[model samples]
Target: MEEAEAEEQQRFSHRQRLKAAVHYTVGCLCQEVALDKQVQFSKQTIAAISEVTFRQCENFAKDLEMFARHAKRSTVTTEDVKLLARRSNSLLKYITEKNEEIAQLNLERKAKKKRKPEDENRDFMELDADVVGSDS
Candidate 1:
């Protein structure tokens, strides 16, 4: 009976260590930030946030994998992440706008690259025209 009790205690200690390892430290950081807002966070509040964040991340990973499989792709894309964020309307709007902004930036970068050579040629042509007209 003593041996069984010792083994049970060991298992309990191992489980406690595992739980501590998985506990999100960022939740404590968030709680510290909340203190600045005059909000007092109890242990329960931190635990709840940690638990919810873990569940959310786990669910998002699972959903993203499922989306990749559904699309017959081996890799997940930004669209999959955006789709997952779409569950929250505000989040969906934010992500969509950010994506559009990123797309616009990319287009601008490509245009700038394409224009560089044309701009150089135009400048050279104007210089040549000025030189020839001045000599004439």
Candidate 2:
């Protein structure tokens, strides 16, 4: 009986940690937004949003973990996040567009780095040739 009670206590402690991990600032932000809109948000309303946001975050993390497991990967990639966002068409489109934009930016940066050294070497060679010809 004591072992069972100890197990229960451990479970409760774990749950407390999990709940603590989720911040309640989202609820405060919601209340602020309600004030801006001239809508009075009660404590209950803030609590509800906080609970819902925490559940949503928990669900998303679970889904991402499932995707990672399905892919036989220990780490979740951006693809896993995109797959999770696939439930909403607008969200999927936005993620896709943003991913493309990031890829383009990375490619541009690589190209710029590659060009800089080659251009500098070419300029140096031209300067060397001009100096040699002038000495003649």
Q: Count the clashes in each prediction.
A: 0, 0
Residue 107 C-alpha lDDT in model 1: 100
lDDT tens digits, residue span 15-129, model 2 = 7776655546766677678879978777777767767777998799999999999999999988998999988999999999999999999999999999999999999999999
After superposition, the stretches of candidate 1 with alpha carbons farther than 4 Å from their true spots are 1-33, 131-136
Tens digits of lDDT, candidate 1, 31-65: 67887787777778777877776677768889999
Evaluated with lDDT, which candidate comes out highest? Answer: 2
Candidate 1, after superposition: displacement of residue 38 in Å?
A: 1.5
RMSD of 1: 9.0
Candidate 1 structure, TM-score to reference: 0.65
